[model samples]
Target: MRLLSTIMLALFLVFSMSGAVLAQEAQTNTTDPIIVGNQDAESLQVVQSYFETMDSNLLAEDVSYFDEQSIQAIEGRDMLTQSPTFMYGDSFTEQQLTPLRYIVTEDVVVVEYTFVGRNTGSYATLPATNQLVSVPTVGIYHVEDGQITGIREYMDSDDLYTQLGYPAYTGVQPVAPFTLPEPNAVDDIVDNPPAFYGQEVTIEGGFGEMVGPNAFTLWDEDFIDIGQEGLLVLAASDGAFDFTPVEETMLRVTGTVYEYDRASLEGTVGYALDEGTFTDYQNFTVLVASEIANMDNVDTLANVDQQPESFYGQTVTLEGHIGDTVGDSAFVLFRDQLVGVGGRVLVIAPDFDPATVENNQVQVTGVVQPVDAPTIVTETGLTLDENLLSDYQDWTALIANEVMSVE
Candidate 1:
């Protein structure tokens, strides 16, 4: 009986070992090159092909691959009730995808691709310009039961701007030629001013002081103003562009003109010149200012900040306050003006006695010239006038023109 039991035990051990080996072999087979018969591998291929087809459809502006029951969730809220629909026809075109590393784990798939676009139409109210932009985007796709259920995309708007030749200015104006039409040619310029009373003309000027939050004061050597009221302001030449952080100087702007009423006066206010008017032109140039102020002040500061090279030896009025008194001899002044979004304060300093300026509400009058570098740091963190500081002894001193009493 003992011998029979031993033989039975040995047979049992061999069968158990055989089962363990088979299990190991099965695990190894699952990791080998995916076979066409494998359901999971087939599902992965289908998902990848779907993405490729969807990319092609997006380029063609055809919204079909979306599931009939699919919904679009933007920023956590469902934006669509049924399948994704395109309200506007072909808003995005010229889509190219550069495949980056992709990872598929369990039920989640992540794809990284560089999306390059050109001549793309605007998605919503953003105008469709011929600007070429490239953005690196990552998409997270959640898959369940062999079907992709959700997708999310991530990218940065500032990165998109940088790809389109729009770099944030550092508050330093560059040297550029300024060409204004002859006074006699004013009749040929576009002169459709806003309904509000104000003159519309394209003028070339250097950047001036910044006033309120996003507004800057513009000035030209030849341009003159009557009073500080009545103006309709907008940013950009076509009145479509707007920006933030008003302390960054150096821009070229063109817009309409309107009168500013008492109720509209918020920041530092300027008036429109009645004599100058553009008959056939609708744009103007704003070469330099602390920052592009707000759209409301664009009409007032437009054409006031001309190109720096145009005002090489001209005295200009700049507003701001004493920021940093470099020494007893010199201190930097901060001025505000409107340019892009609202307005910002610019820093202006010269080689002079800083003792004269008591507070931050002092104005400075100085010659507008090109500085190889910036000498002043605006309150908004942009540096200006760094180059020509050696010529002036106290790089921080500024000539105060007017001092406003702030309570």
Candidate 2:
């Protein structure tokens, strides 16, 4: 999902003055290490040792510590050599990596650290940033069989290039489309859907907004922002799938970004509504899934208030107190759902029927709609509340596919 720029920036030194001075926590290489029934801690130790060894200018010695076919995550299934750690080591006269922290989980060791060094050397034809840099970076190490099988480093490449007084690198790396079962992160797909739409993409995230037994919303990591619900995911049949839909459960889905929303809600419902047209409906972005699976990770809930700042079509789950359900099929959560009062969203859940409890804590998982979230009042011939609808015209709400309680 990220790019080689990340690697290039990471290999750039932090700041080197006199000798390659490095600072790190106590390094431990143990035979019988704490496992906690997993390899996380062990993998972390390997990464720590690898970086510590690098500081000692012993980069070649640690090459054996990686898998023979080690992968660089952003290199598109290429060997780690494509990212070229050896070349990086040879480029700088003095390099130092300061381990900021280590987060171990799911067989991955995330090293949050700082890289510092002055470009007193050269790599290939490129010269260094004479100025010492202190770029913060996070390296993700994937461990398998006690070896680091893959590594992905994240950092702001542009910032590093600017600071170094180097021309921005505009060449695109050789990254082919993902093979089947592999995925492009939802972030990439959402950033520019027109370019990625119609292409097969595998997205993994929180599974909430169960539209039906076979339909739901795929909430990306940025669900709390205005740009929630990456897209609507619909299956063939309500009961024809393999994975179960649980609120906040991680879901990995492979699908094509099919139908574009031409109108708010197609058919007579959206046609009859006097409410102004919603532009996102015409964006030509929706998901028709071919395969769905569970992503073995836990996703946190997206805050309700912030769901509008990013991707609006995202599916998301949020928790907050409910104010009213008096508007028939719709209820309010995360904000004032009551007519004339809008906060986060008004939930439209036709199937959800519970005793109205004012200010009762509840969880709503659903797809984000643009300005005009089509409602039944305009669709199924229910009487419309003109004043109430006008009151919260500018706000957005969730078309709840599933609703539950924090209790």
lDDT of 2 by residue, 122-227 (tens): 6435675567777777665655555555554566555567667776545433222222334565656666778865677888665657654555666663232222
* Candidate 1 TM-score to native: 0.26
Top model number, TM-score: 2
Model 2: residues with Cα > 4 Å off, grouped in runs: 1-40, 54-87, 128-131, 167-407
lDDT of 1 by residue, 1-407 (tens): 11222332353335324554456445654434221122355335545765567532212121122211112122221332222232123554776666443445554454556677774665434556667767765554555565555554444444665555555322222223223232211112223224313433443333444433333444432122211111223332222235542332333334333333322322223333222232211233212122233323332212223333344455655443344444333444432221122111222343344343322344446544433234234321434434434554322232334333221
Error of 2 at 364 (Å): 37
Give the per-residue Cα lDDT of candidate 1 at 124.
31
Q: For model 2, how many clashes? A: 28
